[model samples]
Target: MSSDEVRARVRVVSPRTSAARTRVTSIASEIDDQTRLGEVYIVSLMRSQLRLAVGVLAVLAVTLGGLPLLFHLVPQIGRIELFGVPLPWLLLSVFAFAEIIVLGWLYVRQAEKNEDDFSDLLEGR
Candidate 1:
């Protein structure tokens, strides 16, 4: 093609024009302003944390509190000894602390996960 014909075939494309985009509100701003949506988010986070706490507490109560009842119902368990330490004493002292520690760790991890999810929502992720 001739230079003039080549020039006619080419057209200018505007860089500024594109598909329509929606404006997004910042969650941080909404929260800072204490908007209704922000309140809802906050309440949701609180509820999740509360639910986690209640669940952990319930588990601890059932397992630890049931120990005494179990020992009472089965007196033989107290007579059994492990390396000179009574079975019930070993369970209450050593195993109980381990259980508590595990439960505490689980509670903390779940609580942190809930907070992380809340933050992700806040960040619009």
Candidate 2:
């Protein structure tokens, strides 16, 4: 072959370098870190909310369970009249109102606490 033809036919191939590999590794690590952090934050919030809900449920169960027992033990109290209605009716109405208030308060408080926790997590705290 002629010198010009030989030079023209010569081909150069670039080999994969360590720096490129390191760059890809670093990017993957950063993505993994972000994904793990996000998962941890979600788990923490869910745990906090679950704990709060359990506490609220415990309180509600105690109060609601005691109402029937109280009425049973104190029949006179349940039979007594209040504003032309039986005392039991009044008690039930009041209990229902109180339950609604307590549940609403618990829900609001839990939601706020969860929001705060999530905010803190996002803020890297």
Candidate 3:
């Protein structure tokens, strides 16, 4: 056949959807449903844990933020030396380190707990 005629014939043929497209759409919908369901199952647990974490941080911020003001209001307290540093500075530094350690420990513990729950869900336990 002439190239022009072959091209015209090809153009006349109906376009078909590939099997891959259909399979992909099907899998995408399945994943969407599973994700929605999993969120429903896990969201409350996650929310409560997040709230606890936020509360801890909030308390830490309030306490730490008040320190400088406390020092200013009562200069005598601030003047007291600990390890050759002012009491306020030493307390603030120690509290900052403690906050980091506490947060890290809590995050690891919560992550492990959440992963265990997710594994159980995935295994149909």
lDDT per prediction? 0.82, 0.71, 0.68
Give a tens-digit lDDT track for model 3, residues 14-61: 445455455434433444576664465567557756776787678777
Each prediction's RMSD over C-alphas, in Å, is 6.6, 14.0, 13.4
The number of the candidate with the highest lDDT is: 1
Q: Of models 1 and 3, which has the larger TM-score?
A: 1
Q: How do the candidates rank by lDDT, highest first?
A: 1, 2, 3
Tens-digit per-residue lDDT, 1-125, candidate 1: 69999887675443223221111345677667798977887889999999999999899889998888888899999889999999888888999999999999999999999999987876657
Off by over 4 Å in 1: 1-26, 29-36
> Which TM-score value belongs to model 1?
0.69
lDDT by residue (tens digit), candidate 2, 1-125: 69989887666433346555554445334445777745665677788888888887887777776778887787778668978998778767886788869798878987897888666645445
Judged by TM-score relative to the true structure, which candidate is superior, 2 or 3?
2
Best by TM-score: 1
**Against the true structure, what is each candidate's TM-score?**
0.69, 0.54, 0.54
